[model samples]
Target: MTEEIKIQAQILTNEVCQFTVDRPILPKRSAFFSQKEDAKGSPLPEALFAIDNVVAVLISGSVVKVTKTNDEQWMPIAKQIGAAIRKQIQSGQPLVAEEDVRRSASEIDLRKKVETILNNEINPLIAQHGGVVSLIDVRGADLYLQLGGGCQGCGMADVTLRQGIEASIRRALPEVEEVLDVTDHAAGTNPFYSPTKK
Candidate 1:
C-alpha cells in the first residue's frame, strides 16, 4: 500500500488542541455523522461527544480537527482515528456531499450582490474616513472581503465589520450566509486613522 496519508497531533493550549493529516480522508461514499444529540436532563457543552467516545469533528478547508471530552486521552484515540481516516480516504469516498455544495452555492448570487452592496452602501460610508471595502470572492454563501485605508488596522475594524458592514450586507441580501474579512489587520501600513503624530 502506498503511504499517501499521514497524521500528526499536537496540543495547542490546555482547552484547545489540533490534529492534522497529510491526506484528505472521507470520500463521497462514506457516511457523514451529522446527528447531534446528548443525554436528557443534562445540558451538553458544544464539544460534548455524542458518538461513542469520539466527541466533535470539524472539517475546515483541508484539515480534519477533532475535539474530545475533557476526560479522554488523545494519544491512544489518535491512532484509531487516523487509521479510520486513512481507510476512508483510500476507499475513494467523497469528503462532502455534492448536493450540499450545490445547495449552498445556489442560495446566493455572491459576486453581483456583494458588488452592489459595496458600491451603494459600504464605499460611501468608508470613503468619509478614507477607507475602502473590496470584495474578494464568494464560495458557497461565504463572502471574502478585504478592508483597506483607514479601516485596515483600526482596532475598531472588527466591531465595524461585525456590527456595521456585516449587518448592512445581510440586510440588503438576506441570502448571504456570512461575510468574512480576510484582511491582515496587523500589516496595515497606511490606515486612514493612524495614531502616530506627524
Candidate 2:
C-alpha cells in the first residue's frame, strides 16, 4: 500500500500585510485561535493571542480568519502564529464548538446582505481576478463565503476579502457578525501567488 503524506504548509503576506497560510490544514471545532476574548461563552477555543493580533485559525476543516485591530504588527507576530498552528496540528485538537454551526438572527441578516453584496459589488470587482464569492451559509453572526477562480488561490485574496470585500459588505450591512472565507486557500492554479509591487 502507498503511504499518504500529511500536507505541509507555509505562511505568506498580502499587499495589506495580512498573513495567510500557503496550504490548507483541516481542523476541528475545539481548535481555536488563542487571541479572542469574547469567546468565553462560545465553544470556540480562545486564540493564543488577542483578536487585535490574530490573523486566523484552522478550525473544522476551514480557516477562520480574524480581524486585526489597529495596534499590532503582522510581521513580528507571524512566527508565533505559525508555531501555535503547528503545535495545535501536532496535538490533533478541535477548532470550534459544534454549536457554533447554528445561525443567529443577526447572522441570517448578514448572510442576506452578503449575498446582495456578492451579486452587486464584490463579484463585479473580483471578476478582474477571475474570482467569485458565493454564500455557503451562515451560523450565528458569522457569514461563510466561498472564493472561486483566481481569487481562490491568489496571495492577495485574503487582503481583498478583509479590507475590500468584507469592509464593503459590513458598511452596507452592519448586522454582519463576522465574515468567514470557506475557500480552500491551498487549491487552484497558482494559488497564493501574489503580484509584486513596482
Candidate 3:
C-alpha cells in the first residue's frame, strides 16, 4: 500500500494558507497558479483550485500555498485543501504535468535575470511604499507578474507599473516583450496609499 501523505497546514496571511507535504511535490519546477485556467496541467494545483475560495496556488518543492478571498475564513476550507492534496498524492501519479512547468534554457536565463532586477532594484523602492512585486512566470518573451502588499490596491499601481516596474525591466531587458500584471487588487486589504478605496 502507498504511504499516506501527511501535510502540515498553516495560515500565512488573511488570504493565504500553506501546506507543507512530507515529500517533494514539484521537485524539478516550481509553479504559481493565480487563476483556475493556470492550473490546467498540474493535478495538485488543479485539485487545490477545486476547493471553493481558493484564488491562487504556489508550488515549490514540498510547499504549496493556497490563497483565498480575504473575507473567507480558513476554518472550513483548510481541510478541503489538505484532503485534495493528500488525495492527489495518494493517487500515485505525477503531481504536475511536465509540460506545464518545463522551461527552455533561454526562458530560464531570462527568468533569473528578471528576478535579479526585481530583487536588487524594483522591490527595494516598492518596499518603501509597503508593496512587493513578484515574477509569476515567463512564457516565451513575456512575463506574468503579481503585485502584493501595498501595491496590490494602491491608487498609483498603474503609474508604478508603467513608469517604475515596466520601465526598469525594459531598460534591463529590452528583449522582454510584455510585462503583465496579474495581481488581484480587489482582494487587497491594507493598501498604504489608496487614494480611493478598492
Candidate 4:
C-alpha cells in the first residue's frame, strides 16, 4: 500500500510559506525556481507555478518553500499547495525528468567557480563594508558560505544574502541549487554595521 500524502505548513516569513511532506519529494540538492520557465525538469514546481500567486518555489528535501507574489493569507494558499503536491506524488510521475537530471561537476571545480565569482564579483563589492564571504563547502548542488567582518552581525546581511549573493551565484552557476550562509553572528568580534544604531 502507498503511504498517505501528509503535508504540514510552516511559515518561514511573511512572504514565504514552507510545506513539509511526510515522504521525500526531491533529491538532496534543492532546486530553486524563480520563474515558471526555470522549472523545466521538476513537475512539482510546474504544478505549483500553475497556482495563481506563487512567485518562487524551492524544493529542498521533503519541504517545498513557496513564495507568494501577493500578500495573501497563508492558510488558503498552503492548502492549495499541499493538495497539488499530494496529487503529483500520488500520480507516481517522475518528479524530475530523466533528460533533466542535474549534472554534477567535480566538487573541486564547483568550489573553484563559486570562489572565483565571490572573489571577483561579490567579495570586492562587500569588501567596501569590511565584509568578506568565504566558500565553506560544496556538497551536491548546495553551496555553504561563511560571512565575516561587517556582514556577520549587520542588519542588512539577510537582505544582502538574498538579493546580492544568491542572485550572483544563480546567474553565474545555474547548477548551484542553494547558497546557504553559515556565519555565527554571536561569535562576531567586529561587526561593521550595527542594527541598534540610529
- Report the Cα RMSD per candidate: 11.1, 12.8, 4.7, 10.2
TM-score result, candidate 1 = 0.44
lDDT of 3 by residue, 123-191 (tens): 998999999999877777999999999999888898899899999899989999988999999999988
Best by lDDT: 3
TM-scores across all candidates?
0.44, 0.43, 0.70, 0.53
Write model 2 residue lDDT over 35-106, tens digit each, in one string: 354344443335434423553342434453433444665555555555555555455454344444332334
Where does candidate 1 stray beyond 4 Å?
1-108, 194-198
Provide the lowest-lDDT 10-residue window in model 2.
26-35
lDDT for residue 2 in candidate 4, whole number 0-100: 73
Cα deviation at 170, candidate 3, in Å, is 2.6
Assess candidate 4 and give its lDDT: 0.81
Q: Where's the lowest-lDDT run of ten residues in candidate 4?
A: 97-106
Candidate 2 residue runs with Cα over 4 Å from true position: 1-108, 190-198
lDDT for each residue of candidate 4 in 1-198, tens digit (9 for 90 to 100): 877788989998778898988888875755556678767767988899898888877676798889996568888888889989998999899875543335323454687798899999999999999999987667667988889998998888888888999998999899888788899977887787677847
Which is superior by lDDT, 1 or 4?
Answer: 4
What number of clashing residue pairs does each candidate have, in the order they appear? 6, 23, 0, 0
Tell me the lDDT of candidate 3: 0.85
Better of 1 and 4 by TM-score: 4
